[model samples]
Target chain A: MLSAEHITVRYGRLTAVEDLSFRLREGEWLMLAGPNGAGKSSLIEAAARGVPCEGTFRWQGEDLRSLKPALLARRIGFLSQKNQVTYAYTVEEVVSLGRYAYRAGLFSGRDGDGGAAVERALEMTGLTALREASMLTLSGGETQRVFLAQVFAQEPRVLVLDEPANHLDLNYQKQIFSLIRRWLDQPGRAVLSVVHDLSLARRFGTHALLMDHGKGIARGPIDEVMTPELLRRVYGMDVHGWMRELLAPW
Target chain B: MTETRTLRRERFTPLTCLALTAALLLTMILCICVGSVRVSFSDTVTALWNGAFGLPIPEGIARNIILRVRLPRVLCVALCGAALSLCGAAMQGLLRNPLAEGSTLGVSSGAALGAILAVATGFTLPGFSFGGSMVLAMIFAFGSLVMILSLAWALDRSLETGSIILIGVIFTMFSSALISLIITFASDHTRTLSFWTMGSFSGVSYPHAGALGAALFLFGGVLLRFSPELNALSFGEDNARHIGVNVRRVKLILLITVSALIGVCVSIAGTVSFVGLIMPHIARMLVGPNHRRLLPASLFSGAIFLLLADLTARTLLSPIELPIGVVTSIVGAAAFVVIFYRTRKVRR
Candidate 1:
């Protein structure tokens, strides 16, 4: 289980996330829904241990900060929105970086029997055909799949994705979500995802957290917290009945 | 399955890298053998063996040339090449900019300024041969790096990578101007300053070779160990951090290490250019940007490239001895243009 308490994030003068507290257990899929500038990314970064924040983060009853970076990375995989590659590496090579912590000895190198894990990840993400393609040659949707495959190869217990489907097309969106669903089927693996599309969140998210200006306005099971009244209050719109159905047909 | 696809990519295997390394060693041997006074291959080998084992070989002209002169010169060239190339590779990886190298970052000019100042001041201490001068050069090289980094930080309101490179270019220009100003005022040391700036392998004794050789091995070992971290860094700082790399520590180590290597190179060889700038790129082309392979390959390729350049500098005009820096600059500038065009085309 991953638990965070009294999380406060500050960027110089501005307070991004103030006193935010939440708990995420194994097999739970929590969706963070917020408008722009609502500090969704900030919270994800803090939880991922990528930035400084005032809070206590624990995994399986152990303090997150106390764990070694490599050990923590093995348990928690964090994927940010932008995945820039300055040099051209093959898809397989990029994915193998997920196994960095597991690599042993000096000059153990990347081209070894770690193929089982890498091949499985590629197969899961449907990137088996493009496994040898250079990352510079990949399209946007293909690159996203490659990153997803990389994270899967890491085999982290808690997967934190910040807008995984930000720039993907509809088909890619469906493909990525289905992959996440397969991941969720496994025991002891949890996902915390920031999503902009309410329909997708309503469809895939097991729990919902409504955030506005860095504060959680509502949090509970998906069906209970995504009420029209609360969403309207948070979004400042009359998102009731027909409007709600139109936004989230499922 | 994509098994066929993997076969088609033709990975740059370790064996290929080893073969390249062997080729470099052969070239170094050839360089030592075929200098102004061609001490035939067999004679060169015998002399080198005799010198190594301390067996009594006639102290003839051939033996002296092989043992005292050409051997030290070649060793110095090899060390400079390896050091500069390693620094270049590390700098490029740290900045995430392929254009970042010793020459581009003004490190060469900075070190030149330090060495030139030492020459003009006639700075000498009792019981030390060029030690004080080398110390001054290293300090100045370190100062130049600090200046470049701070200027980049202060000017980078958006913290763009390109701004840091631009800041380095500005520093390069400023350093060049200062070097020229120093040269203009240096009356007594004008010839020495000019020759030093041009760069050569002349008068390099065993002590000089030993110092540079030890530095190359020490710093090169550290750089080779950082391949995985460098691979992580190629994905950008945030991603590297997320992947459990201590990005700050890596950057710090890279900065200090590369600066020191550059300092050592300048102090020893007087600022040879382009081995650092171009060798890494060639290595990347050969083995991809995976530093695990690229770093070692670049080190060998650098040693070869500079040795050949130095050889040409020695033999092209025979006795006239073209400055090694001139030869490297010509070849390096040409390679840079070709690479720049190719990279731009790839980007487009």
Candidate 2:
């Protein structure tokens, strides 16, 4: 389980996210949906320990504020909105970097079993075919999948993805979500993804957090949080009939 | 299967790189041995072996020629070349910019200015001599160090990699103006400072070679040991920090390492241009940008390139020897044009 208590993240004098509080249990998938400039990225960065915040966060009852980056990285994998790589490293090389925290000793010597982990991640992400290809040559969808392979390689307890599906096509979107679903099926793993696509949130999320003006306006199970009235109120659009048809199968 | 394949390729790259390095070393030895004085390969090898092992040799002019003159100059050329290239590779990795190098950062000019001041003022101290060009070189290097550190500190807040490169250009211009001002009112003895500005490997001696080789080897080892951190840094500071790298500490160490290497090279061989800037680029083109491969490759390639450039400088106008700096600039400019064209094509 992961919890953030009264997290207030500020940059200089500007408050990006204030008094944000949330929690997630194991085997759960939570989606954070917000309009542009809604501080979703900042909130996710704060949660990932990429930014400093004035509050306490706990992972499985341990205070994350005191955890070292190497320790935190092993337990929580973060995929930022922008993946900017300057080196000419191959896909395998990039994915293998996920194992850096696992390395031990002076040179961070490779673990004898890391090969198997990397191979498993490649297989899971359907990236085995492109393992040796240069990352510079990869298409947008393929690059996203490669990064997903890296996250899978990390084997983190908590998976935090910020706009993981932005550049991917519909097929890749489904593939990524299915992978997340598999991760969430594990007994002690939770996935928190920031997404802009409402349709994907409706299809994949078990719970939803609707945010606006740097605050959470709604947080509950998907059905209640994504109601027609709430959707109209949040998005300022007519969705009564649409919501009814969308929820019919559920 | 992929692991085995990648391992095999990885093994092959270093082996090939080593083989090329050895070949270059052999070429440098041959260049050193066969100079303006017609000395046979066997005689030159015998003289070198006798000198190295402290063995007795026949009392002849060949022994004097090899021992007194050629060896020290060759060693200086190779060390300076290797050190400059290695510094360039590290700078490129730290800045995450292909064009970043010791000369690009105004380190060379700053070091030159310091050296000039040392000469003009005759400031000699313990463990250091301000007697001649060597003192000037040391002072120039010290000045360069201060300038680079100050610029690095001023830009620490922004911490944007691009801004560092811009700051380097600005410093280069500022240092160049200072050098020009000093040159305008210089005495005859100081006017010879132009020789230091335009590099020459002509007056190299055993003591200079020893000092330079020691500095290069010590600092080069440190840079190579931190190769993995450099690899992480090329991805950007935030990402490197996220991966458990001490970004601030690494930056300071890297700057010191690069500056020291460049400073020592400029002190020993004047401001030899393009070896630091071009060798790393060439190494990257060959082995990609993994610093493990890039660093060693750049070192070897830089040594070979400069040694050959020195040969051309001495041999092109046989009796009237050209400055090694002139050869480097000419060769380096042409090489840069070619690389620029290739990069443009790749971008398109």
Candidate 3:
């Protein structure tokens, strides 16, 4: 399980996330649902040590900050929303970069099971065919899958995703979520994702944490926290009704 | 799959290593033979063979020029070429920008200023002159790196690539203006100052060659070992960190290593601009972006490219001995334009 305590992110006069805290249990996919400027990404970035923030995150009773970066890497995998790659690295090579945590030294080659893990990740994400292809030639969805494969190859106990399907179509959204869902089926694994699409969060997440103006509106099982009353309170609109209306046209 | 990975990780076998050594040695001998005094290839080889074994000199050959002059200059040039190219590749990987190099980052110019100061001051003291100049150059190079990074951070927290290059241009201009001011104040130093603008290695000696060789292996080895970290970094710093690369630590170490490299090269051969920026691109074209391959490949090509450039600089004009930087700059400027255009096109 992964846990956070007194998490806060600030920028001078503005408080992005304030005194936020939550625990993500094993086998649970916790969707951090919020509208724009709701500090969802801030919290995730704070937990991943991507930005300056005040927080203490623990994985399986171990304070992640105290752990060496390489050791912590084996316990947590984070996929950023935007990746700027300037080189023409092949998909296979990019994914295999995940093996760095297991490196023996500065001059070491791939680890013992590095190849097998990369093969599985590539095959699992349906990137095996594109393994030899340059990342530049891949579509948006394919690129996301390549990054997802990289995180999977890391074989961490927890996954932290910041809008994994932000720019992708619904088909890709479903495919990527389904892949992560299938991955979560394995024991001793959990996931925490920051998502704006309430429907997708409700559809895939077993638990939900809703925020509004940097404060938690509701937290618990997905169905309870996603109730019409609380959804209206945070989103300031009838989210369920809007989703139903959109689905009616379908 | 394992087979494919192994094939990708293919390394130079002992046979290839030996072949490369022989080829490099032969090329050096050939380069030594080409000059105003035309020593035959056989004599060149014999002189080198005898020099290696500490044998007595023969009557027919100009062993003094062969052993004590052109050989050291050529060797120093080659060493500087390898070091500059290696530094270029490392800096490019560190910044994740192809345009980033000693010149573009202003590190070379800063180190150039340091070298000028050292030359002016060291004209007095003959012993440890290379050491003193290298030390000053390293300090100035690292100082310039810190200046650019801090300036970029002040201008934009994100530290975008375009802004960093802009800052580099500004820094280089400032350093040039400073050098010009120094030139005005000290007319006596104008000859050395102008000579630096168009880097020449005609004055290189055996000690200079040995110093450059030592720095090349020392700093270049650090870069070669960080191949995987550099590969992860070229993707993105956040991604590299998530993959346990210790991004900040690796970046600091790599930048310091690059500064030392540029410092030593600038001290020895002046600023050979494009070798660092273009050599890696050429190497990438030949061997993919895997830093393990690209680093070594760039070093080799850079050595060869500079050797030819030095040959052209000394011979094309004949006796005049144009500065080496002029040759590399013309080629580098063209490469820079092509690369800039290509990067923009790809983004669009």
Candidate 4:
């Protein structure tokens, strides 16, 4: 279990996320839903330790702050919204970076376990065919999948994703959702994802947190927290009927 | 996909690096052979071997030129070139900018200011007669680097590439202004300062070469060991950190190492410009951007490049040697234009 309480993230004077709290248990997917500038990314960033925040992140009754970064990275994988690799490295080489914490030295050839992890990540992301392609030359959707493969190769117990579906096409987006679903089926795994699409979140999230302008408005089971009343109050619109019609196709 | 395969085929291998090293060694021999007094190739090799083993050769001008004049100069050129090239490669990797070089961060200018101060005030250690000026130059080199790093740190922003480079360029301008101020006031030493500013390998001796070669070996080893980290950093600092690399620690180490390298090169060769800037790009064209191969290839190519430049500087006008900085600047500027055009064309 990962427990975070009263997490406040501040950038200088402006508070990006304030008085946020959430508990993520194993085998759960907690989808963060909010409008633009609603502090979802900041909250997820704080949880990932990507930014400084006033909070306690405890993993299995141990304070996460006490763990070394390498050890923490092995337990939790953080994938940011921006995933641009400026170099012309091939997909295989980029994915191999995910195994850095496990590797011994610079010249130590990738051992059996590292190679297997990279291969598994590539296969899972359906990128085995494009493994040899240069990352600089890949399409935006393919690039997103490539980075996803990189995070997957870390093989962490908890995945913190910030807008992981950005720049992905419809097919890859669906594939990403299903992949997250399959990953959550594992016994000791959890996910904290920031996503915009309500339909996809409704289909996948077991729990949800709704935020508006740096404050959490509601938090509970997915169906209860995502009611039209809360949605209209947060989004400043009555979208109940429109969402129903749009989600009807699913 | 097939294009990637072809690129892979062209990718640098150990054999390629070995061939480059061999070519460098051959070039060194040839550079030693061609000078104001042209020694034959066979005579040059024999005299160099005899000098290396401390065996006495015929007491003639050939032996004296090979051992005293050509040998030390060639070794100094090679060591300084290799050091600067490695520094350039590491700086570019650390900054994630292809244009980054030893002088880009104002280290060379800082060292130049230090050397000018030493010359003007006649700064000298009483007991230690040799290389007092060099020690001061290195101190100022390190000082300027610390200034740049601290400025970046104080900005309260993450050490993003753009911010660091911007700070570095500002520091470069600041140091260059200081150096010009120093040069403006000193009348008697103005000539010396100007000559030093324009870099040369004319008066270098064996001890200077040894010191540079040793420093390069020690620091170059450390830089090479960070190849995997560099590979990660090429993606971006955040990406590297997400993969468990301590980005701050890696950047600090690389910055310090590259600064030390630029300091030593500037102290020895008096701010030989553009070898560091252009050699790595040429090496990357031949080899891929992978540092494991790029490092060695760049080192060898840099040595070859400077040794040839020195030879040309000596022989271009048989009696009056041109300053080595002129040759390197000319070659470097032309190469930069070609590289810039090609890169832009590729992007388009």
Candidate 5:
């Protein structure tokens, strides 16, 4: 399990994430929910040790900082919102990079074959058929899937997704979410993702942590934290009623 | 149609490298024949064979032309080509930008400035052959590269490709301006320095060729070892970092290694632009983007390109001797335009 206690992120005098806390356990899909500028990303980035923050962020029992970057990479695979790939790397080549942590050394040999793990990741993301296809030729959704497969090939115990579905169409979103769902079915695995879509958080997440103005307003079971009353209070609107109102004509 | 698809799909193989090597040797022999005093191919080869093994001299043009002048110049140009191309590929891979070659990145410009300084001041580090200017060139190359990269980072945190290349160009101009200032003050050395900046291998002797060859092997091997890291970095630094590439460390090592290789080249010759810039794209088109294969492919291709370019330089107006940099710059500028648009196309 990965957990953060009273983590706060600040840029100069302005605090982006103010003492927010959350923990992710095995088999749990924890949705980090918030409206715009709610510090959801700041919290996730802070926990991932990508930003300056003050708090206790632990992986299992050890301080996450105590682990070497390469060691920590093996434990948690991060799927950032964007991966800039301008070169003509094939699908297989991109995925094999997930094994970088395993094969990295200053004078390591040229035997950089990721082999079975790369293949499995490709299969899991339904990219095996396009293994030789260049990343340049892939569509937005396929490109996203390629990146997902890359992290999956890393074989991490915990997956940290930063809006994995952003810029993706609805069907692709469902497909990506379903792939992650299946991944979580495996033993000794957990998921923590920043999600803005409340419906997705409610549907796929077993627990929810809602934030407003850099403050965690609620944290508990998905049903408890994502309730209409709390959601309206945080978002300053009738969350469920407004969504239904927009969908009525459709 | 099949040829296009085959070219698209083909991975650079060891067979391709071997074939290029053979072609490079043949071209070099043929190129050696086409100089001011045209020696026949058979005589050129005989001269090379006899000269290489220290056999008894066969008098006339064959001996002096093959052994003394043409051989060393060809070898120097070829080594410079390989080093420039390899450094270009490494820079492109590290920065993930086609525009990130030595000249555009100000590394070569800085080396040129250093060489010009050595020439103007009559400064040469003792206890080294071609050591004074080249040593200074290497130092300045590293210095300029660090300056350009830091300036780029300061301008933009994300280090967008366009912004970085812009900084490099500005720095190159700045350095060139400084070089002109030095040449203006010491007008007597103007012609030597001007022709030198245009980049010709006329000045390269056997010792310079030997030094360039040595640097090629040393720095090239160091670069080749980082191919995997370079591959990871080509995608982006964050992805590289997440996958456990010490991006900072790898960038630093690659920067120093490439700058040294380029510095050695510029000091020995002049700013031989575009051998590094244009050759990688050609090699990449044929071989794909696996740096392991691409680096060697670029090396062979660059060597061949420079040999041909040098041949054209001397033969195009035989005895007039156009600067080799002129040839590379013409091709490189056009390629830069095409790449600039293509990168824009990708953006849309």
Candidate 6:
């Protein structure tokens, strides 16, 4: 289980995320939804320890601040929205980099299980066919899958993905969400993903948090968070008929 | 069959590097043997062996030239080459820029300025008897270190790799102008200072060879030890830090190592250009950017390249004996042009 208590993130003097608190139980699937600059990304980044924040976060019973980066990486796999790899590393090589925190140094070559782990990750992400391909040559959707494979290789307890569905098409997005759902179904696993598409979030997310102006507007089960009143209040869109049409299947 | 072919190709890289290293070493020995006074290879070998064994060989012109003059000069050339190349590789990794080299970072100029000051001051104390060359070398090396640190501090926010190169160029220009001004004012030492600026290994002695060799070995060892950290830094500092690398500390250590390496080379052999710039790039192209392979390959290839360049500089014009710097610049420029054209075509 992971919990954030009253987190505040400020960039210079401007508050990017203010007084945000949430908790995710084991095997839970949570989605963060907001418009551009709604502080969804900032909140996730703060939680991932990529940005500095004034708050107390705990994974299990231990303070998140006390854990070293390598230990933190072992417990939680973070996938940033900006996934730019500068080198011409092979797909397998790129994925293998996730094992960096697990290894002693960059070139220790001591982990005998590395090859097996890489193979398993490639199989899970359906990237076995592109394993030998250069990361520089991959398409956007394929690259995202490769990055997902990297995080999967870490075998972390919690997966934190910031805007994981940005460059993906509808089919690829569905594939990704299904993968996340399957991952969360495993024992002692949890997932927190930032998502934009309301329909997809409605279908996939077990719980949702809606943010507006650097503060949470609503947080609960998906049904409660996706109501017409809340949608109108947060997005200022007349989604009454749209909500009815969207929630019909659910 | 394909597996066998891949294995064969993989085996060839190390084999090729070894072969080149041996060939260059042999050529350097041969060049030393055959100077203005023609000493046969057999005679040269005998004199060298006899000298090594402390045998009472015939005291003549051949022995005198080989023992006192040619040996130290050849050793100095090899050491300078290796040191410059090592510095280049480290700079490239630290800056995370492919074009980054010792010269590109104003390290050579900084060292040069130090050497010039050492020469100008003519300061000779009981402990420091080497005069301006040694003092200037130390000063120049430290100057480069300061420049790199200041650049790192100033560009803390964005940390664009190109800004480092631009700053390096600015420093290089300033140092060169100051060196020129110094040369213009010096009386009888003007010719000597000018010769040093052009960079020659003609008059190297045992002490010069030993100093350069020691500095190169120490600094290069430190660089090789941190190859893993270098590989991590290539992904950018933020990513490296996220993966638990001490980015700032590593950068400072690398700066000091490269500065010291380049400093010793400039003080001993003057300012031999382009070996530091071109050798590491060639190594990267061959070894595919992994510093583990790239560092050693660059070191050996650089030494060989310089030894040959020095040989050509000495023998090409025969009696005239052109400066090694001129030869290196001409060769480096031509090779760079060819590489640029090929890369452009491939990209197109």
lDDT of 2 by residue, B167-286 (tens): 766877787677667766666435455555668888778887887888778989889877767876776665565555667787878777777677667766777877887899888888
RMSD of 3: 1.9
B100-191 in candidate 3: lDDT tens per residue? 88988889989988877766665323577568778888889999998998898799876667888899999998988887677777767544
DockQ of each: 0.51, 0.43, 0.75, 0.45, 0.49, 0.29
Model 5 CA lDDT for position B244? 73
Candidate 3, residue B218: how far the Cα is off, in Å: 1.1
* Fold similarity of candidate 2's chain A to the true chain A, as a TM-score: 0.92
Regions of candidate 1 where Cα sits further than 4 Å from its true position: A104-114, A239-250, B1-18, B58-61, B114-128, B157-161, B181-198, B344-348
DockQ of 4: 0.45
Better of 3 and 6 by lDDT: 3
For residues B178-228, write the lDDT of model 5, one tens digit per residue.
888888898785445555567888867888988999999999999988888
lDDT of 6 by residue, B105-193 (tens): 67788888877776676754466455457656766776775766488559764444457667777887888888887777764453365
Residue-level lDDT tens digits of model 6 in A1-250:
8998998999998898899999988877788988888899898888776689998889987889898777887788887666655445568665665665677764354245555666778899999889778776787788888878878877788988888888788888888888888878889998888988888788888899999888988998989998888888888886667767777999
Better of 4 and 5 by TM-score: 5
Q: What's the interface RMS deviation of candidate 3?
A: 1.3
TM-score leaderboard ranking: 3, 5, 1, 4, 2, 6
lDDT of each: 0.81, 0.76, 0.86, 0.79, 0.86, 0.76
Model 5 CA deviation exceeding 4 Å by range: A109-113, B1-12, B57-61, B187-191
**Candidate 4 residues B20-68, lDDT tens each?**
8789889999988898788888888889888789887866548878888
- Where is the poorest 10-residue window by lDDT in model 1 chain B? B1-10
Interface RMSD (one decimal) of model 5: 5.5
Model 2 bad stretches (over 4 Å): A61-65, A236-250, B1-18, B118-125, B130-167, B184-193, B340-348
Candidate 6 regions exceeding 4 Å error are A47-50, A61-65, A84-87, A105-109, A128-131, A169-185, A198-204, A238-250, B1-24, B30-61, B118-163, B183-198, B334-348
TM-score of 3: 0.96
lDDT score, candidate 6, position B93: 74
Sort candidate 4 into its docking category: acceptable
Which scores better on DockQ, 3 or 5? 3
